[model samples]
Target: MKYQEFFSITIEHSYFSGGPADLIVYPEEKTRKLLEKQGFLLKRTGTGIKVLLPMRDNNRVFPVLTADDLFAFHVLPTSGTVREFTDISEIEEDNMILFTNEGLDIGTIELIKSETVKEEVFQNFPALAKIEIKGNQITTDVIGTPPVYKAIFDSKSIKWKYYLLSKSGATDIAVETRGDQLQFNELEIGNNSLDPIITSLRLNFPDTKIAVFESSVAIPLSSKSIKDIKLIQRDSVTQTDSILMKHLPNPSIYDQGIQIIKIK
Candidate 1:
């Protein structure tokens, strides 16, 4: 299998609400070959290739590479009758992928920014490999027998940030500015639950607006000021199953999956 067979990139039509292309594009032969090796059927009409629907029955057409996506795939189109192909010259420099292995396979895919690889083949890589899939991005390092936790707080200026005495699991926190208020967009608790992280964050930034993502009813927190907490239902069909297939081995440390919370 070629290096590119280990992965494919996709974005939903919602990603581009402006317009759709009119060209009968075929993802340059190399890209088509790679995707086909991975079980993707490149639908061909009598005279032209057709676009496949984006996953999850989305309205957007996916797999059509822009200049940047082509650079990430490290392919240049030779000659094509297609009117909407991504020209190699238009590719952004930063969009190029740097693979650890010469023949980029699943175990050697270098995670850069927000990119995904074949989930089923991901476990062959080291446990410490940083992986970003769906809304979750995790990287782990071994410490003692169990892994220690590293807290990632998302804020411009947290009152007083403190390093963790011990690490637990990889945690993700995202905050976005909402007018004058700092809205905690999302929080994925570590393996140890919300107590430790919440305590530490509260200690650092006492009274700040925050929100937690939760599936069930809100659990009362000691901080009465954290009343902005919002309860959200978990996706009935989550990408977790795809990313964390039982066949794929997890790191030694326990993972708390993800959770949400809010404070104001």
Candidate 2:
């Protein structure tokens, strides 16, 4: 035995407006075959339907079906202009239009539009040359005579690094550089005091934000808090922090306590 699920069906009709002359009923597979024998073709895709029909003067295609009262008709061409069919019970008359044939050829339209935009941009900016897109970075090379201008694709690269560190659950620290600035979200200290860490960081970065967090209440060395050090409270430090801080500048601690100090 097979179980069957009951479902309701809703019919949709194509019409420009709710008018007495715009009522249409689409043909079923059998009816479509009968119409095809008389000289009409129906093309259907996953999304839409198309109908092709012949006329007295020339052939025409209607992409939509229309209903008029108790009669259904396809759009046809009149003279050189296309118009909707108003006659009913004339399925043998080739007047219906298929949507698949009337709509803009999507592939060709996209190609043309893309080409047009590229050409327009190139023409407007004569200096524009090659464009390179990598992940979130976009680099565009501009044509120049002697001096080439290389610009950083994104200035937010530095800001994104902080977000990445936070997501990775990594301890953030501020490391001063000779030319570059190292910023972190959290830092861990070992046997050393916070004062030395600040001193070392300031010697390097001179301007950087370093935040520190520890599990226990560690007393920081007796010195003015640097402008770049920030201390917070954490439950504990991982072994990695302890090992890595050894190579870090000025990683000294006076005692175990919560201290937020900035080294400048």
Cα displacement (Å) at residue 56, model 1: 22
Q: Among all windows of ten consecutive residues in candidate 1, which has the lowest summed lDDT? A: 244-253
Query: Which is the leading candidate under TM-score?
Result: 1
lDDT of 2 by residue, 107-169 (tens): 221101011111111212211111111111111124211111111110001111110112223
Residue 169 local lDDT, model 2? 35
For each candidate, give its TM-score against the true structure. 0.16, 0.15
Please give the TM-score that candidate 1 achieves against the real structure.
0.16
TM match of model 2 to true structure:
0.15
Misplaced by over 4 Å in model 2 are 1-27, 44-48, 59-264
Q: List, residue by residue over 124-172, the lDDT tens digit for candidate 1.
A: 3211111212111111223212111111111111121112221222233
For candidate 1, give the lDDT.
0.26
Count of clashing residue pairs in every prediction? 14, 38
Shift of residue 51 alpha carbon in model 2, Å: 1.5
For model 1 the local lDDT of residue 79 reads: 27
Taken over the whole model, the C-alpha lDDT of each candidate is 0.26, 0.26
